[model samples]
Target: MTDNPLSQAEYDAVTDAAAHWCMRLHANDCTVEERLAFEQWHDAHPLHAFEYEYEYEAMLEIWDVAGDLPRPETVAPMVRAKPATPWRTFGIAAAVCAMALPLAAYSGWNLGWLPDSYQHFEANDNVRQVTLSDGSQVELNLGSELTFSNYKDQRRITLKKGEAFFSVSHDTRHPFIVKAAEGRIRVTGTKFNVWMYEDQVRVNLIEGSVLVSSNDAVAGDGLRLEPAMQASYRRGDFTPRISQTYDNDNSLAWRSGKLVLDDLALTDALPLINRYLSKPVMVADNSTGSIRIGGIYNIKELNNLVASLPKVLPVYLTRNKDGNPVLNSIPQQAPKS
Candidate 1:
């Protein structure tokens, strides 16, 4: 009975319809009329029935690989005597549960219910822009990922990795909170940039005020921040370094596809540059790595900078056995008296 194969467009249409039917059945107040309508729609065409079955089976396969997917508390009982409710509805529900598992295992944040409960946003290799449920806007930098979990008490975000710029919506009743490995940031409403990686977390405020606190500290006792200010926390440190000033444009330069560094150390800057390149750039010695350099770099065109670094600094590039480039320091010349 499942002989007919559907085209991609036809399959998508059928699956979409099946999904809607699944939601209606799962709705708490699903009426008998809706159930009857669904029965009619399913019986209207053989292709419809087949597509629904295909979707259901696919969902089961996903469930096999992805554990503990969420589902509605209850679904309305099937009204028709013969050919009960399509398993497609169950599969779609299960697929929704498994949607976030593929990346969760590796990302270090795995609460099985997050895929169903939280809103997820990610930018892979290139910058991405998204609007939050509360009308707030977010720009995710390359390779960054974050999830939003909003509740009646507060709006919380778990920044998994990389950096993100948030233009928060004003909601005094429910304050906004961002939690990273480094610490937690609390604000009523604000515009800010957060970079989280390894054991380091940096929060740069462009506008609005935020309270920065250690992961274990109470929000009331966190450090209060103002515009153009930055707070950085290192792992194992008792407190975060706050009240530092930063150039707003420099902090947010990634939005314009540039890496603008103001005399940042080569060692420190390579990490940022490595985020954009397919291969990593490394220094051979402390001297080469410690050289302070400042320039606006085109992240997309890194080859030019890597080729020209030797001329400006007392450093030279050499390839390893694997042909990966490494920067080594040149002999220090005698200083002029």
Candidate 2:
């Protein structure tokens, strides 16, 4: 035990730094250099190192109790310590499954976010985890625009762009509905993630279930998803269908700030990247529509996504006047020795 006991000043400093890093990471605009800067800041001080380790252990302890952020588990403390507990853990269960009576404690803030400053985004980009008044939790992905309507009868969200994982509070009358790009997804129970673009939509179900349908089209043709399931819809397509199944881990892992793309195309990739950025990444030619790129990237940064190609294909990535990223292919040079 390096130091099981921590003073208030030390504890505040640690959680503050940890919270900044937490918020910075959620902003997801951090460059490699920026990430390195944080690492240096964390390691520079002995107190910082100890607090980070302890806070991490505290984070893991919290996760161990809750399983995840969206669907937090109830974790009541077995014992109280001299210092105040900084974490709150909750309990959640899968949809349509019998749940055991949880020996769970319900305390601490789920994520150490200021209530007054909780929902606002500052500097660079922000991914906010918002807990609605009704009790449903939403982790708004980077560069995401989330507006919640807390009405006496209904709760609604309009995701302008980017992605979000919703652990909807089970309110039958409220019926949480998300409106995005000519489609609407309604859920009563369980947890799911929805990724939206100008022309396409993707939904992945981790635990529980959800009903996905096109608001622009017939609801009858909409698809339903269970745990480990995914669905996608593109404009001009005939119907929506269940296309893939990702293990809950792979499906909901982005909550930890990773991008999960499954053999998506450059054309498809463009809008996804643009969702997290202010400036659009325009692909000059539509002929390259089928050029494919895959793998989970930290939607937090654009560098990894730009690294998808090399050799033979000429690709250019640069920041423009408006500070948006533009990606297009350059004419390949003739082979030279």
Candidate 3:
């Protein structure tokens, strides 16, 4: 392996070429002519071999994490055919790369030629904090899933589910966009919160400004929100209802491990509360879902809250056959029997 470092452009070209060769050589439909061509390319220069080895190693790592790999016998011939070299000792790298090619494409590797890279993040049981390449910050609430891609001219985030808070770094050249469900929140730099439910998306702006628009919305045809403002729209709705003023403290209570349910329906509130629980709370029927409640509760004391639900609301908590907590409307007493 050559120890010399190539320039950025040169390194990118080599890696791009190596990635293409890696894919072509391992393809099920790869031809004899293509295999010969790959060998020639690999031996053309030491840098080519070095980069190919690196790319092969990366693909193997991805497959290792995924716990799926091609059989060693299927890939042994490719390595044994090559002349003995420091970079050609691995017998399974090419097979692993070929097996994971589809995943690589889905993950935005695109044969290593795409300028933008993609990342996925999830907060399964606790909040997660992430810093982007451009210095922007994100905080994902429990059970939230986020996908990110940074292009030359844009920083995009897809909120696949649940909620997240963002503190974006100022960058006029590259707009920051957050996509949740069918809606998009666009800004140059700002602090905001986004919550994505099954049928709705809510945006709360804490600093700077943002444009809340739908996927099919026309230019300048979206709602603009300033500090202390909020907006929400259901899936497929292009127009969002904007609230000029909102309760900042209540809106952001989750960051402090608290939930502030101010007149929110039980159905609407359970989703937020269940994010902190191992077993989610479910409504027994639609009648129980319609009961509105208000209170501030610590997320850590979820069991206690479940026990006290009957005291504050006209609903009682029971356990299902599987031991999952279920909320049901209280049975009214008979006037005469």
**Model number with the top TM-score:** 3
Scored by lDDT, model 3 comes in at: 0.73
By summed lDDT, which 10 consecutive residues of candidate 1 come out lowest?
Answer: 107-116
Write one digit per residue (lDDT tens) for candidate 1, span 131-200: 8777788999887988775655667787888899999999999788898784788988899999876677
lDDT of 3 at 165: 97
TM-score of 3: 0.64
Better of 1 and 3 by TM-score: 3
| lDDT by residue (tens digit), candidate 3, 193-308 | 99876767889899999999965455563778989888988888858888776553487887887789988898888877776677878899998999998888876677688778
When sorted by TM-score, best at the front, the candidate numbers are: 3, 1, 2
**What's the CA RMSD of model 3 in angstroms?**
10.4
Q: Rank the candidates by lDDT, best first.
A: 3, 1, 2
lDDT of 2 by residue, 1-337 (tens): 3546777886676767864553353333558887888789877766665554444434333333332233223343233232323231111111101122222352222222111111222212656777766688888776666655443444556666667888887878757767666666777766888887676878888777777775556646267777777877775555556866734335455567776667777786667666665556665566555567667777677654554544423566665677655556677689998
Identify the leading candidate in terms of lDDT.
3
Which runs of model 3 end up more than 4 angstroms from their true locations?
Answer: 1-22, 25-117, 217-221, 247-249, 277-279, 301-304, 318-325, 334-337
Off by over 4 Å in 2: 1-124, 151-153, 216-221, 234-239, 248-253, 260-264, 294-296, 303-313, 316-337
